[model samples]
Target: MSALRIALADDQALVRAGLRALLERQGVEIAFEADDGQALLDRLQDTPVDVVLSDIRMPGVDGIAALERLRERGDRTPVLLLTTFDDSELLLRATEAGAQGFLLKDAAPEDLHEAIVRVAGGDTLLQPVSTEPVRARYRYHADDAPRALFSEREVSVLRLMAGGYSNKEIARAMFLAEGTVKNYVSVILEKLDTRDRTRAVLKAITLRVI
Candidate 1:
């Protein structure tokens, strides 16, 4: 089989060098390297890699911003974000910005390799798929109105949305009427206080609601 071509983008030369060595040992080729998101984009104009591994923070144009620009330019290249910290808000932004996968810089080499391959094969590597962590993030004040809670079915709908299922597809999969699914989505948006389904899902993930 042909080797996987991967690109690295990070302000830290040491980090990129380590990742390059590690990935090369795994039978992957370094397609290119960039120090920031803008440089990555400029390079991508000519070089096409199977996947992009980028640091979440850089001097200019962070990973999330790069992913957004990629989307705006209709670039479907899969991107995996690397972070040095577990910042929930940044994670949410990355998801919303259309990152295919992400990992902490210190993630196991095996896991990192697997994540790159999986994302290249069209899978997302978001964490805490189970809801317990999400539930733990929920906090409410007694004086304030009870935080909006989605029903079991609504949460199911939101999960499908996160998986990129259309409303019609979600309705068919959930075995609910199309109109019912629409209503559920509307309710989900309201509960999450988001303007759209994408934001709703991202916000829900951030709030640990889904």
Candidate 2:
């Protein structure tokens, strides 16, 4: 198998060097390194790395903003946010901005490596505290009301989404093609006014729509 190509984006030189050393020891290839988010974007335009491990707070175009810009530009490269900021709102915003995974800066090297691999494999990882905030913040609406906006199939997809199933998993579970699942998810996001899957799930649960 080919080694995963990765880009490191952090303002601190020492931190980038340390992470590079650790990933190199694990046989992952460091495609390039950047001092900030803009630099990271510039590198990506030319290099086509497989994944990005970025610090949340950088000088210009912080990690969240960078991910948002990438999504706006239709870049699908996986991004794993490596940062010390574990605030609930920050975590939520990162997910909304299209981050594939999140890890604390103090996580073990093995954990970081695993997170990168998982993200590259199209999985999402979040710190327990970060996930808990998402789960705890779920608000259910009135029980007697009907969900009028969605068809029965769409409602099934939304319930699975609320349970944190990705599009692929939802496709497999519902016996639908992945592209169809993606379309359903896109329609769901549009109807719910959410930027990403996580927020769409939260909003569905809150309004008792799923």
Candidate 3:
């Protein structure tokens, strides 16, 4: 396969420098870099990279707005969001904006590289740790009501997800195949009417479903 081409959007020059170095070492090409989300979007008009790694808190457009702009124009290029904190509000917004994944700025190089490849290969790469805070932040919305419609097994899968478990980990914990766990996650997301794992967990907490 051709080397993965990536575009980065972050305001901090140092962070971009570090990321460029790390991704370069992994045999990935830096299609371009932008100091803010608008510039990133502008560059994308011509660069046409395989994936986009963007900071959520950029000046002007910001990552969320940039993604929205892309989608508004029918740009389906996968986008991976980067954040400095595991903020639930941001997670929900990013999920709703159709992010392909979430990454903490301090994530290991290997994890970052893996996330890029996974997203490029048409898989969502959400880290449980990144969404745990969203769960806690929205836990206050829990209310006593009739349980949301989810199978017992599905609830078990969601509980593991809230605990920051990946599909592989959830499969091992539940003694099911990884593909089964992925299916369960997809069902949970659909049942909860959320776009991604982080939003699903947050919505589940808000409704006390899990």
Top model by lDDT, which number? Answer: 3
TM-score of every prediction relative to native? 0.67, 0.67, 0.76
Looking at candidate 2, what is the lDDT of residue 20?
Answer: 94
Model 2 agreement with the true structure over 37-154: per-residue lDDT tens digits: 9999988988998899999888878999999999999999999987664445466678778888778888888988887887898876653224445445654345523334788999
- The reply for model 1, stretches above 4 Å from the true place, is 128-210
What is the per-residue lDDT of model 3 for residues 30-135, given as tens digits with 9 covering 90 to 100?
9999998889989999889899999888878899999999988989999998876745457766767888778888888998898888788777665433445665
Per-prediction RMSD in angstroms? 5.8, 5.8, 4.1
- Which residue runs does candidate 2 get wrong by more than 4 Å? 128-197, 200-210
As for lDDT, the candidate ahead, 1 or 2, is: 2
For model 1, how does the per-residue alpha-carbon lDDT over 1-210 read when each residue is reduced to its tens digit?
Answer: 799898899999998899999999998899999999999999998999999999888887988898899989999899998865444446555776788766777789997898788778877665523334333454433433315777788888888877656678788998989999999888887766667765666567656566
- Quote model 1's TM-score: 0.67
**Candidate 2 local accuracy as lDDT?**
0.80
lDDT of each: 0.78, 0.80, 0.81
What TM-score would you give candidate 2 relative to the actual structure? Answer: 0.67
